[model samples]
Target: MLKERLYYIDSYCKTFTTRVVKESLDNMGNWNVVLENTAFYPTGGGQPHDMGLLNGIQVTNVEEIDGEIYHTVAERLDPTGEVEGVIDWGRRFDHMQQHAGQHILTAAFVELFGFPTVSFHLGKELCSIDIDVEDVSAEQLEAAESLANEIVLRNLPIETKWVTETELDQYSLRKNVAVTDEIRLVIIPEYDYNGCGGTHPSSTGQVSAIKILSTEKQKRKVRVYFACGGRVLQQLQRKNYFLAEASQQLSAPEDSVNTAITKLLETNRTLEKALDEAREALLSFEAKDLLLNKERGIVKAVFKGRTVKELQKLARLLVAEADDVIVLLVAETEDRLQFVAARGAAVEMSMKQVSASALLAINGKGGGNDAFVQGGGERTMAGEELMNKMLVSFNLDI
Candidate 1:
């Protein structure tokens, strides 16, 4: 037997009494009860299921399977007598406003530019409709939004009616109906006429307002994001809060916040460039001092808290100053050790030999050509010990 859909009869019906025809455990082991008549709307047509209490047991989900509407509840109930079901009005009305807003906005797009809405989704806080176009301009969005709100302000009646396939020709439809039997059409008078199975408000004014938040390209179409009714107010409140916080932190008025932020970023970039130049000058002075203490045309030094890049820069500066100099530098940090080996253009020894011996002593990995090599690994051995191992491999007298 087909259950009477009380929601279709009266979308405003929040509470109803219905007899439970059957009760069983669903595939996921949840209790599902089928009622002889129900006001709860099932999840379908991009709209979510209605949720509320069914005889005090919370109805978690409602779905239609094989033409029967099953209400999934927290606990099992007797399949013998009637049960009282209540709909969450807040959620129901929010959906109504958004769904209706979509219809109005969709019609506005078609009426203004012949853009057809191919799909729609009613999300928790926002709603979207994908149009059959590659792109939509900001001006088009503004025009559509303006026209949609005008319809809402006019408060046109929203009507729904069941029609047969043969009777569908009496009025022009925005799109073809998907179902042949029990064809339901939601009409906004001479403006929008389309087949839909989701719940909506009785009139356009109930939507309160419609705002197109943004749009993005999806494949060959454009998806428009929007919010309606109470959601619009919530979005405005959230954005205002963020702007207020930014203004206070920047010590600027709301209207001048953008200018202040841009100026701050520019100042930061200038300071960073100056710091880099100063650090490079200091490294060059230190490299010259180290060259003065060289022994046997080889310079060796150990330092703390220096990066491998800095060590490489210092070694390069040392070799550039003397034609016969070879530099070996090690930097130690809390958890690791880094070293650089570089030789002047006139030096005969390959720095690769130094890196190979140093890497083996610390169980590290590094690579370079005949003149320069650098590497770092876990601080398994003391930096001085590793440097002594490399010197031995070099067969240097020092």
Candidate 2:
């Protein structure tokens, strides 16, 4: 026998008693029970399923398969007995408000600008409608929102009718009905009429309000994000909380918070630029001192806690300051060693030869061209031992 859908007859039906048709265990080891008649709306049409209780057992999920509504419960139910099912009224009502609000907003766009809604999605915290348009302007969104809320305030009756395919021509539908056998049309007087299988409230006034939060371009179309009824208030509360926290942290009033943040960012940029210039000057002075103390055309130095980038900069500065100098610099960190080798333009020997020989002693890997080479590996040997190895590659007595 076909399971009677009590939700279609009355969306407000929270509780109903029905005979248990079958009982089975799903793949996930959850118990699924089917009832002869169900008030729970199964997951369909971009709307989630209704969750509640069936015979005092928690109904975790509700889905329809092959014309059968299976209610997944926390516990098993007797296969041949009657069971009382209760719908979670709060979740059901929230879905009703959001679904109805979408119809009104979609109609408003079509009525004013001839833009049709291509698709709709009802999320947990927000709802979205994709329109068949390249872009949606702020003015257009405001106008649509205003018209939708106006319809809600008018409290127009929301009517649903079941009709045959031939009778569909009697009414002006916003879009073509997908099913021909049992077409269900949701109508708001002459304003909007569309075939939908989702649940909705009895009147538009129950939606409370409709707010368009934002919009973004999706390919060639535009997606409009919005919230209705309690969701609108919830979004507002969350935004207000963030604003309050920002105001306190910035030590500025809510109205002046943006100005304060802009000023702080500008000040930070200026400070960063000055600090970079000062560091560069210090490195230049250190390079000149190293050149003055060079021995036999080679400048060698070991640094603690210096980064590879800093070593590269210092080596470049030292070689640029002198015409006949070869610079070797090593930095020792907690567990690894880093080294850089650079030679002045007048030097004929390639730094590649030096790095190749020194890298072997440290069991490290590095790469650079002939004139300048850099690499680091394990700190198996001390910094001085690595430097001595580089000198041996040059056949220099150190």
Candidate 3:
């Protein structure tokens, strides 16, 4: 078959109609149609397919299989008839926005840190690029991101060129060229020259903004995730919308809202602390009423379905007061049971066994070490029954 002239050769060529040469569906249910010639760029180089229309049907995907490129249409077209393929300018331009930003950002990393991007994955959420480097500190990440934004602000001219291996011997490629034989290099003027098969914008100035979302350490590699162009602007627009609403409700400017909230939070924290201290003092007085009578020699305390924090705090208080110190704390939240027991050399208590029994009763799981025992079983039993079972099994005075 004669090779079709790739209309994408002219990245600026967005509108073109071509005859559908062949179409088939793979086992994965993706449609593959080879055109006589196509302006639609297939999924490649961390960029998505250039989606558009095929004879008025929406073209959702374009892919390559076994060196043959295919365009997936929304509806089945007459394989025998000539079908017109048109590129969706809105979608194509959005992809270009992200692609161009990525090139500039990736180039900035190499230029500033001497580390090159090993691979890039573009997705709807965020575009991620893995760099060849150890774990990058937050500050180091900030620096790279800062540099990328600086380039974005600079809006340097971006240019694309196709050069033969022999002719390009004088200039250095960004990384190892997989196939230097016939390479299409996307150039950012004085910034970068990388072998890229994806379509790109005419210049960097088209990418209005770039934002670094976050970075995570994946194994030994550092992955930097970011958003670019339209996505960045979209996020800012949403943020501003919320800010405006908040500013109106709070009677403040968007800039001072965060600072104002921070101050309010600090003041609230002081008041909350004072209230907590007063409550604790009152709780200590009421806790004396929960004192267990020493008969056969068991120190116990009764508790309602409370938080572990409250129970633990009471246990510590009782442990300090008891001479023959064996303290068992009980709390149940919702349907779950929690038990905290601690003995300070005054009694022998296996924490693991206690945790086990409590878990079995509640149809859950828990464990602890020596000097502390805790058990929780199903919440099938009410507060009274649950407390009674623990007292009988653990041989404690309720």
lDDT of 3 by residue, 1-398 (tens): 21234544666676776677787877878676887787887888889888878878888887787767777776778777666767788777778888888888888888877888988888875798999888777777778778878877777777766677876775677886776566667777677888887777777768877888888887778898888888897777887899999888778888899987888789999999999999799768645654555434444555666776776677666656664566666675666767776655666655455556556667865555776655555666665555565566666645
Error of 1 at 305 (Å): 11
Candidate 1 Cα lDDT to native: 0.91
RMSD of candidate 1 to the truth, in angstroms, is 5.5
Go through the candidates in order and give each one's C-alpha lDDT. 0.91, 0.91, 0.73
Show how many residue pairs clash in every candidate, following the order shown. 0, 2, 11
Sort by TM-score, top down from the best: 3, 2, 1
TM-score of each: 0.74, 0.77, 0.78
Give the residue spans of candidate 1 off by over 4 A: 1-3, 269-398
| Candidate 3 wrongly placed segments (more than 4 Å) | 1-7, 19-34, 70-75, 112-115, 125-157, 163-168, 209-227, 292-305, 325-329, 333-335, 349-352, 375-386, 395-398
Q: What is the Cα-based lDDT of residue 137 in candidate 3?
A: 76
**Where in model 2 is the C-alpha error above 4 Å?**
1-4, 275-398
